[model samples]
Target chain A: MSLFAVQLRREWLLLVQSSEEILNPLVFLFLAITLFALATGGGPDTLQAIAPAVIWVLVLLANLLSLEGLFRRDFEDGTLEQLLLKAEPAFLALTAKILVHWTFSGLAMTVLAAVAALILYLPVSSLGTLLISLLVGTPALSLIGAVGAALTVGLKRGGVLLALLVLPLYVPVLIFGAGAVLEQMAGIETRAQIYWLGVISMASLTLAPFAVQAALRVSLEQ
Target chain B: MSMSASLSVSQSLKAWWHKLGSPRWFYEISGPWQRLFGVLALVLLVTGTVWGLAFAPQDYQQGNSFRIMYVHVPTAIVSQSVYMLMGAAGLVLLVWRMKLADMVLSAAVPFGMSMTACALFTGAVWGKPTWGAWWVWDARTTSMLVLLFLYFGLYALRQAIPREETAGRACAVLALVGTVNIPIIKYSVNWWLTLHQPASFTLTGAPSMPPSMWVPLLINVLGIYCLFAANLIGRLKLTILERERNTQWVRALVREVSA
Candidate 1:
């Protein structure tokens, strides 16, 4: 458990030092929203109508940008090899890595989403749901993305392939996450969307660790 | 025979089954089975298609365009089922280190991709009449498109790596990871509000279709399964031949075929 904490701390420090990795996606999120505004004539009514989808699409793209590093770096540097050989289970180590990735990438996206929401003129009432949805939903993204990353860890030019593998799985998360914001904005009850989001996150959290462990073993064997 | 003697005979059969985990043994054994399935598949497919396309009732909603279901539903069903089948084979290969399982995974790819393409094309044809558009980003259609991409990725992974064993393991891992998409594709409409309709056919639940409509559909589904089995066996044989060209049995088979 202490090892996991140390690993988490190490990942955080790396994320902090690599400001571009953290900041680039945020930049993409804002730029995409800005482009949408420009393309659609910057009308408040139009922006509000498209805000939930645009935000979710941006989040998906931003997540794609950071997904490559989830396992590629560790696998390349021999760190993953040592971890595989460690006495503590690889799944725990992988879970901690995914958690750290979510904290840095997913949480950062959530913060940027707030600014984008304000710019897009989303109703003030929906802000809490949007934030909460991103908070609960992005970890699921990282966890599922970890499976793709681990599977493609040893392959050459695997970035695009990883996207192909992971994006389809991202549908459920995208559906429920975006639905929560959309429902809230539309003045409907978002309880069902929130429930589904929680369910997706919980399910991924439980299952993805085993998948990552299996992938990491195959990867390390090679 | 006494019970103990019968048990011994069955135990030996199980031992032989385990030995068939070797690619060479599987390749040799499946040769006759492949031919048998190939002929059976051809007969079933021809019969089912003729029956469904010619004899079945036109939909009150869709007219003759609904005839595309004969091709579309079977291909879609096989496309999804084949992925599950391939993923299961991949899991066995990865976990058990069975070379025969690797050959099965390889064999399953081209068939899966062809089925995916058939589904997509037939879907477009069906959509033109029903939806008044060639395409929509409906959940089912979108997920099927993604499934096609997954197949391409698996094929590409196989091509990129030089070592057969390493390639097999890598592709297996990708296949297993990609299995997450299968259920989402199956339940995408139920899980989220989408333009795609919910499932019409289920095992335990009541079907949306009447008996006249669905009986041919079942026949077509079985026909597709037979076709997949036949194609898979053919592909596995070719894969084994290519991979085992240096082995004595392959050499003998090549000489025999050429002669």
Candidate 2:
């Protein structure tokens, strides 16, 4: 099998073996939606008003909660060193890890976000925009978050530091992702927001692996 | 010592200037310039602050509170600009492996932090009167806070890494990657229809400010630039001393300076 495929399979197994990692973020997503429903009096109008931001913020926090393990396990078990030394380019390996990260966190967030959108009374028409935005934007999060994870891989209590490093970088993705849904809700053409989000994701995909590779080299060097 | 000799001397000076692309040459030559700029910066800062605070006119709308702009606007501008400077340093460090680039990155952080702090403080003070609140989560204010966090992240990442070269590379990558925020900070108002006003100053066109308002702002900005240069020099010197302590030249220079 190709290295990328093998890496992806291995990561899938690892994520499955740690089911809580996958389930916890979904729970957090559900709980956030629930809290917003309760706190805002379960009024559809109010929930709809704040739903885009609430959903985006929840996804952000969920991804952040999962990011610490992205590189920590490999660094701890010496697998990261092996990957670094492999003949295959480190950027490719970084890309594979990011793919796995997105598959687990980003894909799960997409599913849970759909459910959350329904609960929040997001318009039926806006659902397509929400899903498309998440599909494009979430991988960008994983890709950028990989750089943060690689940089903080072996540090003690890296979770908070990882959030500190990665969250601000997520703002553009948040702006566009949430903005797309808002635009759709407002009866404007949402194409520009999606196009910008796609552009950002493409730009980040092209550039972030190098940063991840550089950061991983530094992490392993130490 | 001859006329042709003088011409050769000027040529060599130009050659040396060209070689400043090397960190070692930069470290060697920047020592004296650092001290000179440091003194100049201190003078400019003191004079500018006193002139700005004591002499600049109150805004027609903002009154004495407008004087806070003397500190706030300049620091806010410098905070973003310094992030770009650090990113340039990061690019040099990554592409060329210049140790001075690492030093430049390190030198920039404290200055960046101070500038961000000054901006936040002045923003808060200005907000109290203008917005009727000490703080608001407006786009500009929120993004400036995020910028502060980015600076802290760079510093914290540097501390977390155990090896110097590793730290340098990691922080450099982080700096380059995080620089996307600078433009966002600059245009957040335009992007979101934000409460914060769009930029008052522009390069290609006339400024929004009347002459009375802009002249002192221009001076204050120049003064802050001078101060940033001075602080950078001091920080770079300390970085050189720390990194080069084992070297003979550093030891000799230390002895000479102490003497």
Best by DockQ: 2
RMSD of each: 3.2, 4.5
Per-residue alpha-carbon lDDT of model 2 for B186-251, expressed as tens digits? 453245533223543222123366766666677778778877887787788788778878888888
iRMS for all predictions?
2.4, 2.0
Clashes of each: 0, 0
Evaluated at residue B82, the lDDT of candidate 1 is 90
lDDT of model 1 at position B190: 52
Question: Which ranges of candidate 2 are over 4 A from the true structure?
Answer: A1-6, A13-18, A38-43, B1-28, B46-51, B54-58, B184-189, B194-208, B253-259
* Predictions' DockQ, in order: 0.51, 0.52
Best model per TM-score: 1
Candidate 1, position A195, lDDT: 77
